[model samples]
Target: MTSIKIDRSACQGYGNCVLALASVFDVDGEGLVVLRRDTVEPGELDGLRRAAYDCPTDSITFVA
Candidate 1:
């Protein structure tokens, strides 16, 4: 199992994370990143990595 973390302060509202995985990431009204879901299942690892990799600000990280 895995979990995700978001550093809102580091988020630039690029929405790349959302684009990579909308089921786990969202954009708030303030244009900050929000978590739709934090837990990452084994099958979701690829999408998780994509979201983390796509984040230019590196606001999202995963813990296993």
Candidate 2:
């Protein structure tokens, strides 16, 4: 399965990733990006890519 990775140190927590894909990304109470799940479903690949692309800090990446 393809999975996602995030660099916590590089994440700016702009919430764009979350906005782009709520099922895959979330914002914690402290305003940080949280990965709800690492693995991606084939149907959700577009959403995953959108989330990664929308990340303001470019902190999200795919590990296929």
Candidate 3:
């Protein structure tokens, strides 16, 4: 399974990840991006990667 990790300290609440992969990520009421699903579904790998890469602070990490 692919695992997703986010560094809250480095996150700027840009919501890029949420917009890129709503299934695995979302912006909470505070506007901070949250990982709704830590493990990526098989078909969602691409979107997850895109979200991680799109993060301006590079706060997202993927582990296989």
Candidate 4:
């Protein structure tokens, strides 16, 4: 199993991560990025990677 991490302070609410992996990322009412879950399924890595790559602020990260 893999783990996901986010830097809330560095997040800019661009929503790129949510667009890439909505199951794992979401936008709060404050327009900040929030993690729906921290653990990543093996099949979800591609989406997770995509979300991380799409994050303009580099707020999304993972440990595999």
The best candidate in terms of TM-score: 4
Candidate 1 contains a number of clashing pairs equal to 0
Which regions of candidate 4 are displaced past 4 Å?
none
In angstroms, the error of model 1 at 63 is 1.1
Q: Give the higher-lDDT candidate: 1 or 4.
A: 4
Q: Over 4 Å off in model 1, which ranges?
A: none
Q: Model 3: residues >4 Å from true position, as ranges?
A: none
- Per-candidate RMSD, Å: 0.7, 1.0, 0.9, 0.6
Span of ten consecutive residues with least summed lDDT in model 4 = 54-63
The order of the candidates by lDDT, greatest first, is 4, 1, 3, 2
Q: lDDT for every model?
A: 0.92, 0.86, 0.88, 0.93
Query: What's the number of clashes in each of the models?
Result: 0, 0, 0, 0
Residue pairs with clashing backbones, model 2: none
TM for candidate 2 is 0.89
Tens digit of lDDT per residue, candidate 3, span 1-64? Answer: 8998988888889999988999888887778888887898778899988998899999999987
Model 2, which residues run further than 4 Å from truth? none
Better of 1 and 4 by TM-score: 4
User: For model 2, how does the per-residue alpha-carbon lDDT over 9-29 read when each residue is reduced to its tens digit?
Assistant: 888779998788898888888
